[model samples]
Target: MINQNKKTYFKERISSKKYGVLMKKIIIVAIFCFFIISKFTPIHGQQEKIPVLMYHHLENNLNSNVVISPENFEDQIRTLKEEGYNSISSQQLYDFLNYNIKLPENPVLITFYDGYLSNYELAYPILKKYGMHAEIFVITSRILEKNEKNSYLNEIPKMNWNQLRAMQDFITIQSHTWDSHYKLVSNNGVKNAALYGPGYINNNFEEQLQYEERVKNDLILSRKLIKEKLGYEPIAISYPFGIKSEDTIELSKVAGFKMGYVIENKKIIKGDNLFSLSRITVNGNETGDELIKRLKS
Candidate 1:
């Protein structure tokens, strides 16, 4: 009888120990899973940074140095598609900056400047073919004043209100500047500035202030016109001729633009000022391989 009792007690103790061991293993696995999930879960309110690409004319007739041929453009788009790059809108960029939107793994923002009519005729079809969207920065004054008699691309017409409205459904319409790109001369002695927009030749502090004020007024009018035409205020602006100044950034912010774009070879990343985002220029001179190399490097 004594042996039987001892055996029963030992068996119960062994069972209890085994159960405790199993429970401990289960707890460890649960804790590890929790850790992994926490690591992968999206953060609630962190801004994401990504690169924005700038492009101009898409034609073979323009200066080969500054225009991207249609075939090369198609090739570039195909490469991006094959590589799984997701092209998003400017609003998406703003959301990523303001809210913690989880952008795709390889995200890019494609933009076209000058409101070229070719953008509507040629680039639009190609973009739609690739299931991509782009942002177009229009010179509001030009759009408002463009007449039917003016020749665009020697064939296609400049985007009228109907076409512009249709584009707004797929692309985000942003402001470039009002009367800012006819002839621009920066105070830094850049020669092409005069050809891009208004020249800033004055060196006096008061004169500089006046020049800045004039620019601000023009930009303000641009914002109003964009709002009137598009029914929403634009939050982004590209400096005319990619010319930037400290005063220009401040004025842009005051004019209600949250971000600004510049033409540079660098890709945008975190810790960059929102008002001075860098862009990669796409011109006709670059082949698909060269463009890829430039972007990758």
Candidate 2:
């Protein structure tokens, strides 16, 4: 028992230490994003709870954990409609957060990360039939150019820019990162500097300059290409994998993203931290009623 207790304590100590460092690394990005947003969209002084539901794929191959069946997805949307949950955009949230604008009685924002092919084909039609719109954070590099080999592991390939354009009538397409959607792994550790988790990207992890340079390039590259291709500036960035920290949060500001979204398995609300916003990731099998129940609980 004593030995087990010691092991648990040491494990927690190491975990806490790593978490602390990660939080510290986030400080610069957090403050930077805060400064930019404060100028126009100040944080709301009042509390307003809003749920931002996240979906990845509208297909089912049972290969990835993020897949949600088209039927299930439609059911969820229907449930939201039946429940009187009005969908809102990140811009609306931002305005509400900053300007204290009046929002609908029950505002829920539906967001899809990793622009999947099914989004344009399956999800778009369903959302349209329901007269609902959503926010799609796209991966610029994955947006298939003509004749490009779709070797990415999306199961169903990502939607092309043309298809995305057609969906723009009801969908608010945004940036998920140009080339930062993938992961970087090393024997020492792994870093998702696209929107980093904790560790530095440098070999020694001491070269802060190199880290910021890579971060800047990655962030700016996505926004630049997105603006050039999509013909409109992307207002928000949904961090790839919903992974972001203070560093990435501030980088979104430098990279030209006004709002940032991260996954924290909680409902977002007005007066919520803008840069470090949380979201509830919908599982593949959980039906709409189940999601509603989870929200209530």
Candidate 3:
């Protein structure tokens, strides 16, 4: 009777040991599958953000201080194309931020400020040649009236209504300001450069309100003009001469601008201060190699 009981106990122990080994194998396989699925799934940490480059003027006249030579502009675009860099519009960027739409690899944004006629004349062709899109920030008040060529300060004739409307099909148009005013002031004397800069200001207030009622009015007027002329309101804006204060940013937000661009010299990174977004300045002095280096850095 003792021998029989020993055999039965030994058998039961052997069966339990086999079941344990099988359970261990099953757990290992499940863990391996989980890792494989996670590896193939999309993760937010792996995404990249591209830089937005800002340009002012593109022209053949090298003597012009703010102008970039057409040849250099062409070279820059050609190099970008050769390097497989994809250029996108400001709206596309806005969409990417608002939604999780995946932009093309090596995406870039090219923007021009001041809406100089040279942009429409020279830069437009080059951008079109490369099949790339760009954004142009226009000063609504500076936009030359129909058949009116004479303007103050040799303002370099702005794009006319027809030109602006035509370009709207290819490039995104945004507001710079109604006028190139810096701050809002009441008295004309205070608005003068001797008191303040070449921008507007209100003498009623001692502290400069960068985003005063006057500034908001200008933005509203600019939006109206853009809508009437281009059939759409601008979603972005470039600070005139890259000038802004904390109040100015708030005013811009109130004016319904989704993105505000600045001319600072730095690489714009994720979680960067939105008001002071950095841009690479492209001018006649910068070579293609230098531009590439700046972008890479």
Task: Highest lDDT: give the candidate number.
Answer: 2
In order of lDDT, best first, we have: 2, 1, 3
TM-score of each: 0.75, 0.76, 0.76
Cα-based lDDT for every prediction: 0.74, 0.78, 0.73
Q: Report backbone clashes per prediction.
A: 8, 2, 7
Q: Name the Cα RMSD for model 3.
A: 5.5
Error of 2 at 52 (Å): 0.5
Over the stretch 1-297, how does candidate 1's per-residue lDDT look in tens digits? 999999999999999999999999999999999898766564674434466878777776553645677787888877877777789877777666657465777788988887777788888888889888899888776673444644334533446555677776568889888777745445565555321333554543236556667778878888898788778888899988787777788888888888998877677665577888888777666666676667666
Clashing pairs in 3: 182-199, 184-201, 184-202, 185-201, 185-202, 186-202, 186-203
Candidate 2 to native Cα RMSD, angstroms: 19.8
On a 0 to 100 scale, what is the lDDT of residue 260 in model 1? 90
TM-score of 3: 0.76
Candidate 2, residue 240: CA error in Å? 2.2
